[model samples]
Target: MTSQVEKRLAGLGLELPPDWTPRGQFLPFRKDGVLVYLSGQICEWAGEVTHTGPVADTPEGIAAAKEAAKICALNLIYRLREACEGDLDRVDVILRLGGFVNCHSGFPSSPAVINGATEVFIALFGDDGWHARTAVGVSGLPGNASVEVDAIVRLKD
Candidate 1:
């Protein structure tokens, strides 16, 4: 396999979760004319939930959710690239994303934390780096993970 994604992960010094799971019926991504719509994803490693509390807003929140968001971005890269047959270079735009942070009260910087994902996208995609996004503070999220992300990407055909 060509190493666009593996190289990206190695450059970041990160490992795949070995267990990121999709909680819903929808497929993780759908492609239509250079657009990839990613399903919502949470921090699951080996079918187990991590960051099992308020995301980025509590003392117990895993520092890794932010990191996980970065990882998720990597996962997104592979998702899109693989969908297009390893053509990440054909990626044209990030259409939208709904950022869900499962947090308790007093979560002051959820946006900042989610920026971990945002930064990774910018770094990886460069000019195709920005998207319409919503960062929401949710009472709870599936699997009780601290953060979850859903994205829509547009690419070159």
Candidate 2:
């Protein structure tokens, strides 16, 4: 049976990718009671980095970084589904998101870039998707990804 979340994803023309294995030694997600914590996800798909290098601090750079953030969101959604046993409807709420953007010093648009991920969750889950978030500029990230996002989710019992 198609879950409500799956239906919503279809409505948005979004498809989750196949199961992903962490390239590093870290776990993708960890569950404690009803909460699931997702590790940081970058803008990579099918084993290729969609966007590489530190984000530029120009308008065009922010736009590109936003797109990269969206990719990271998609990857996070994929992991969330896995954490939910393939049923996203089990997600009660998105508790928080931590966004990191690799950029030059003093870049002030990290929040704008991370909004790409936040918007995706809101589109998917409506009010339930609204989450506490921390968006910060970083000197570098793994693979030099433009953006990386980690999430904490609460699940329905």
Candidate 3:
């Protein structure tokens, strides 16, 4: 059966990628009670790591970083599918999102970049995707990715 999320993705011309493969010791997500905590996902697509390096503070440069942030959101969507056992309808709400941008020194627009990810979720789940968020600039991220995002999701009982 096609999940609601799958249908939503289809409408957006997107599809969930394969099950997330953890690159390190930590699991991609851990569930406790009705909540799922997702680990930080970097900008990776189709086995290729995209959008590396520090984001500049210009319009064009920040746009590129925002695109990277979108990719990270897609990665989280796939991982969320796994956590829900392929049934995204079980998702109750997106509780929170934490975004980190590998930005140039003095760059202060991380929240703008992270909005790329936030917008996607809102499109997919409507108000259920609206959540608390934190966007911050960091010196660097693993694999030098331009953006990374982690999420807190609540699932239906």
Candidate 4:
């Protein structure tokens, strides 16, 4: 059966990726009690880094970085689904999100870029998706991807 979260994703014209394998020596997500901690996900799809290089502070750069951030969020959602045993409806709340934007030193638009991921969660989970977040510019990221995001989620009993 399709979960409500899946339906919401369809309504938003989005779908989770088919598969995601961690590229490093870490689990994609770790569960502790009712909380699931998701590792960072970059803007990679089908094994290809979609957005490489540091983001510039221009309109086009921000826009592209935003899209990259969205991709990262989708990937994180994929891991979240796995952690929830393929039932996203089991999610109680998105507790927090940590976003990193690969950009030049002192880039001021990291928050704007990370909003891409925040919007996705809100669209999919409504009030439950609202989360505390930290968005920061970084000199570099793994895979040289433009954006990466990690999450913490609470699960319903």
lDDT of 3: 0.89
Model 4's TM-score against the true structure: 0.98
Query: Which run of 10 residues does model 1 get worst, by summed lDDT?
Result: 53-62
For candidate 3, lDDT tens digit of each residue in 18-110? 554666799888999989999999988776678986998889989999999889989998888889998988989999999999987788899
The number of clashing residue pairs in each candidate reads 3, 0, 0, 0
Candidate 4 per-residue C-alpha lDDT over 86-127 given as tens digits, one digit per residue, 9 for 90 to 100: 899999999999999999988999999999999999999999
Question: Which 10 consecutive residues of model 2 have the lowest summed lDDT?
Answer: 14-23
Look at candidate 2 and tell me the lDDT of residue 91: 93
- Full-model lDDT for every candidate: 0.68, 0.90, 0.89, 0.94
lDDT (0-100) at residue 52 of candidate 2? Answer: 78
Clashing pairs in 1: 19-46, 28-39, 55-102
Evaluated against the true structure, the overall lDDT of model 2 is: 0.90
Q: How does residue 153 of candidate 3 score in lDDT?
A: 98
TM-score of 3: 0.95
Taking all chains together, each candidate's TM-score versus the true structure is 0.80, 0.96, 0.95, 0.98
By lDDT, the best candidate is 4
Task: Kindly provide the TM-score of model 1 when superposed on the true structure, using C-alpha atoms.
Answer: 0.80
